[model samples]
Target: MDASELDIVDRPAASARGWRVPLLAFARNPAGSIYGTVVADSVLAVESERQTKLSDLIYAELITVIVYWFAHVYADFLGSPPSGSRRASLHRLAVTLGHEWSLVTASFFPLAAVLLAAAAGASIQTAALAGMWTGVAALVLWGQLAGRRAGRGAVVSFAYGMTAGLFGLALILLRVLLH
Candidate 1:
């Protein structure tokens, strides 16, 4: 099972471990659970409200995954092959997939979490700011990975920017329409 699935199954166990230990553990490994918590919460909220069919919810999550994949590719491997490199092409493919995986891990999870938090009555300021920061961090990583390729970096950055913007827009629309 995926990390999110694991979290759902273990949340009771974690709670049984006691709130204090879990809180400390959460504080210690903030990044790891933060995203999973968000996605799980969002999934639960949607499932609870019956606003979306299960198939559609899964599809939406898949789109979020795709966005991350593009963002990663735009960030990491957009330039010419490295110098004196016999494995340049292979490295390119590998980085491309790595970026895709990063999207699954980094970007979408956080976005989903923010959305879930908002649904759970988190303060608007908290959800919006957290989401923005998380999305920006992902974009920054993408740009940094893009390195010296001016055009490539710009493209990748733009894609991620758009991804983040869409995330915000979707959340807002969902909030208004769902309630």
Candidate 2:
């Protein structure tokens, strides 16, 4: 089904519970979730190494995701054929942005992890690590969901999950190499 169909399935519930829609959208946009998580992890790794404060780190991560989301939306909107009417063009822009909203939503859990860890009195570094791991876990979960959605068996699904987790690991490896 196309994005419009997916939007029809999600838009009403999304309007009712804005915060929850992204989690639901995950099934439809696993790639967006993975992309967001990888980006979040990269930001966390780099900022944590800088010994940044938790508040600053969180703000930076959020702003980074938003900027990327806007960029993705703009690129997608540009790639679409130009609509005839101005209203139609605006609608297309809205649809493109809404479709890419998963990028911002995917960062929610990892940011929450960082906030929760800090609330529990963890150091900024440790809290950032928690957030990074949460992103990794999200990636793995998205992979498993995708596999199952495709009717794969449990073992193969798990392998897919691990493979997705590798993206996070690669960022971690880069962190280690840089530091």
Candidate 3:
């Protein structure tokens, strides 16, 4: 079972014993979840000039994003050596890295959407747009979810969501301007 689903009493023992550490790391650091989508957004904004093969675009987007996500996990795990024996340390690493699995999963949705659209004979450009917009939608949804947790009402939550989601646009702008 996933760490998050375990009863609360089990969590401490599980971590102490160096069990799968997904939820613990997530509770500690949520930033890893955005790695894939953020990298994809930056890459697509700067290099999405329509010359690449549709398959290349779809594959490259997902691969680059996932690779970068792994790098983040690696960096995070290494930067701080968690307390415990070698086994426990390794478990801690796994726990920390596993939280970032969400980053890969998040990127997968848009990548698949793009690939499916292109396979269905959509224009490469249109398929790409569909994929990018889908990612933006995901970001906005994350924002709304965060807002609700913070006790914001629906409209205010939407506003916050849009604001957070627009940060993706800024990333795009940075890529376009700087690269």
lDDT, candidates in the order shown: 0.48, 0.83, 0.66
Worst lDDT 10-window in candidate 1? 26-35
| Structural similarity to truth (TM-score) of each candidate | 0.32, 0.80, 0.69
Writing each residue's lDDT as its tens digit, candidate 2 over 51-121 gives 55777898889999999999988988888898999999999899777777778888887899999999999
| Better structure of 1 and 2 per lDDT | 2
lDDT string for model 3 (1-179, tens) is 76666777676776774633554343222234344556666556555564368767766787887788778778888888567689888888888667667676667656776778888998766676566666677667656655665778999989866876786767655645764
Q: How does candidate 1 fare on TM-score?
A: 0.32
Candidate closest to the true structure, highest lDDT: 2
* TM-score of candidate 2 to 2 decimals: 0.80
Task: Tell me the deviation in Å of residue 153 in model 1.
Answer: 28
Superposition error at 20 for model 1 (Å): 16
Question: Rank order by lDDT, top first?
Answer: 2, 3, 1
| lDDT per residue as tens, model 1, 115-137 | 76678876544554455445445
Clashes of each: 1, 0, 0
